[model samples]
Target: MEKRVVVTGIGAVSPVGNDVDAMWESVRAGKHGIAQITRFDLEGQKVTLAAEVKDFDFGDRRAAKRLDIADQYALVAAREAMADSGIVSGENVDPNRFGVYGGTGIGGLATLESEVSKCVKKNTPARASALLVPMMMPNAIAGNISMEFKAKGASFGIVSACAAGTHNIGEAYRNIKHGYNDVVIAGGAESVLAPISFSGFANMTAMNPTTDPDRASIPFDVDRNGFILGEGAGWLILEELEHAKARGAEILAEVVGYGATSDAYHITAPDPEGEGASRALEMAIEDAGIAPSDVDYINAHGTGTPYNDAFETIAIKKVFGDDTKVPVSSTKSMTGHLLGAAGGLEAVICVKALIEGFIPPTAGLQKQDPELDLDYVPIQGREADLKYVLSNSLGFGGHNAALIMKKYED
Candidate 1:
C-alpha cells in the first residue's frame, strides 16, 4: 500500500511577512508585499520595484560563520519547520530517514555578484576567499540545509525555474508516499532581486516598469503589463500520516495529488492553447481520485504577463469548464513572482486557505481582461468554506505543475 503524507509544519520568509502566522495574516488580508527594490541600486533602471523580505536576520544557525543569503533563507525556514514539527532533535528519530529538498531558480545570484565585484577591484592584491565558490553555488542552499538539519535522506536541489519551489515540495511528498522517508523538509528559497537579475529582466521586457507599484503585477486584468520580481523562502514539513499521529503533530493539510507537464512549445512563453497546463491540472485531480468540480479554490499561475495570464485562464477553463465558477486568484498580485520560490510560497497560501476556509484575493486586479474571463477574486479577498485548493505554477522552458491540498479530516 502507498503511504500517505500530511503537512505538519510550514515556515515562510516572504515579502508579506517573515513567519508563518504573520505571513498568513497578510496573505489572508490580501495585502500586497511589493515595494521599491532596495536589495541593490536601482538609480536609472526601467524596473525599480520588487517584493523584498525586509529585516531578516539569520545568525550563527548554519556554521557560526557567513553563509549565502539564499542558503540562510532556507536554513531559517527549515529551522522553524523542524521546531514546529517537534523534530528538532534526532536522538530517537532516525536521521537517515529525514530528507531535505530545497530549490531556487537562480541560486546565489547576489553572492555571485558580490564576489565578481570583489575579484575585479580588489583581487589584484590577493586571491578571493575559498568560501566564495561554496557560498555562490546554487546547490549550496540544499546541501547546507541538509547539513544544518542533518537530514540524511534525499538531500538535493531541483531547479525547474519558477516551478522549482513547488516541485521540491511535490517531490518530497512523492518520496514520503513511496515509503522512503517518514519525514521530509521541502520548499524553495530565492534572493535574486540583484542588479544583474533586475537588469536582465528589464532588458527582456519581462518586468513591470510602471511607477505605480499598486497597479503592477495585476494578474487577470487587461491593464496588466508584466510580472514584478520578488524574493523570499518557504519551507514545509511533510511527515507520514502515522508518524505525525504518533508525535501528535498538528496537521496543516494533506497532499492529495501532484502533476507536472512540459509545454514543449516556448522557452519563456506558455502555449497559447495551454494544453500542457490543462493536462497537468487534470492529472493532479486524477491523482487525488477527485473529479474536476471537486476542487473548490484555485490558486492560479497568473503571472500578470499577457501570455501567461491568458494562457492560464484557458487552461483553467479547459480543466474546470463551467467550474469556472470556482474561486480563482493569483497571490502573485501581492507577493510578486518569487520565481523558483513562488511554488513554495503559494503552496503555503493554499494550505492556509484550506485550513482557514477562506480564499485570499488577487490584489491589484482592478480591470478585468476580456480574453481571460474567469472568476477572479479581484481586489477584495473572500470568505469561503474551501476544502481543496489547487496551486499552479508555470515556469520558463514550459514547465507546468499543479498540486492539490485538501483540508485534513483524519
Candidate 2:
C-alpha cells in the first residue's frame, strides 16, 4: 500500500527573514529582501546587489569553523526543523529509517574559490587545506545533515542546478510514500556570493544589472530584466501520515504530487514554447488527482529574466488555460532567486500559504507585461481560503519541477 506524506515542520534562513514565521510575515506584507551586496566588496563589479542573509549567526563557532557557509546554513535550518518536528532519531523514529536529502547548485563555491586562489597566488598546490574535499563536496550537505540527525537510511545530494531543492523534496516524498522511510529531512542550501560566482553570473548576464533594490527582481513586470542572487537554506521535515499520527505530530500540509521533466532542448534557456514546463505542471496536477482549475494558488518560477518569465507564462497558459483565474505570483520578487534553494524556500512558502489561507503577491510588480497576461496577485497580498498550492521550479540545463501541497485534514 502507498503511504501518505505530510510536512510536519519547516525552517528557513532566507533574505527576508531567518526563521519561518518571520519570513512568512515579510512575504505576506509583500516586502522585498533585495539589497546591496555585503558579502564582498563590489568596487569593480557591475552587479552591485544581492539578497544576502543579514546578521547570520551559526550559534556554534567551533562547528561553523569546520563547515562551509552553505553547510552552515543547511545545519542551522536543519536544527530548527528537527526541533520543530520534535522527532528524536532513536526515541520517536527509527534512526535507521530516517533519511536526509539536501541539495545545492554550487556547492561550497566560496571554499573552493578561496582554496584555489590561495594555491595559485602562493604558487604551491599544497596551500589547499586537507579538509577542502569534505567541506566543499556537494554531497557534504547531505552527509553532514545525516550525521547531525543520525539518519542511517538513504542519504544523498541532488544537483540539478536550480531545481535541486524541489528535486530533493520530491525524491523524499516518494521515498516515504513508498514506505522506504518513515521520516526525512529534505531541502536545499546555497551560499555562493563569492567573487568568481559573481563574475561568472554577471558576465553571463544572468544577474540583474540594475542597482536599485526595488527594481532588481521585479518578476512578470514589463520592466523585468534578471534575477538577483540570493543565499540561504530552507528545510522540511516530511513524515509518513500514519507514522506522524501515531507519534502525535502536527501535520502542517500534505505533499500530494510532484512532477519533474527535462526540456532536452536548451542548456540555459527554456523551451521557447514551454512544452517541458507545461508538461511538468500537468503531470503534477494529474498526479494529485486534481484538475488544473482546482489549484488554488501557484507559486510561479518567475525568475524575472526575460526568457524565463515569458516562457513560464506560456507554460501556465498551456496547462491552466488562457483565462485562468488562479492567483499566481513569484516570491522571488521579495526573496530574490535562491537558485538551488529557491524551491525549498518556495515549498516552505506554499505550505505556509495553505496553512494560513493567505496569498502572497509578486512584490514590486507594478506594470504587468501585456504579452504575459495572468493574475499575478501584484503589489500586495490578500486573504484567500487556499486548499491546494502548486510551486514551480525551472533550472538551467533545462530542468523543470513542480510540487503540489494540500491543506491537511483528519
lDDT of 1 by residue, 1-410 (tens): 78889998888888888888888888878788888887777787889889888888886655634677777778787777777778763863579999888888988888778778778767652556578788877788889888878888888888999999888988899999999998888889988888888889999889989878899889989898899998888888998999889877889899999999999998998899999999999989998999988899999888899988888888988988944698899999988998998998899888888888888998978899976777899988888988889999999999988999899988
Full-model lDDT for every candidate: 0.86, 0.93
Candidate 1, residue 326: the lDDT equals 87
Clashes counted in candidate 1 amount to 0
Candidate 1: stretches off by over 4 Å: 61-65, 121-125
Q: Mind giving the per-residue lDDT tens digits that candidate 2 earns over 337-366? A: 999999999999999999899999999998
Q: What is the lDDT of candidate 2?
A: 0.93
Scored by TM-score, the top model is: 2
Report the lDDT of model 2 for residue 194.
94
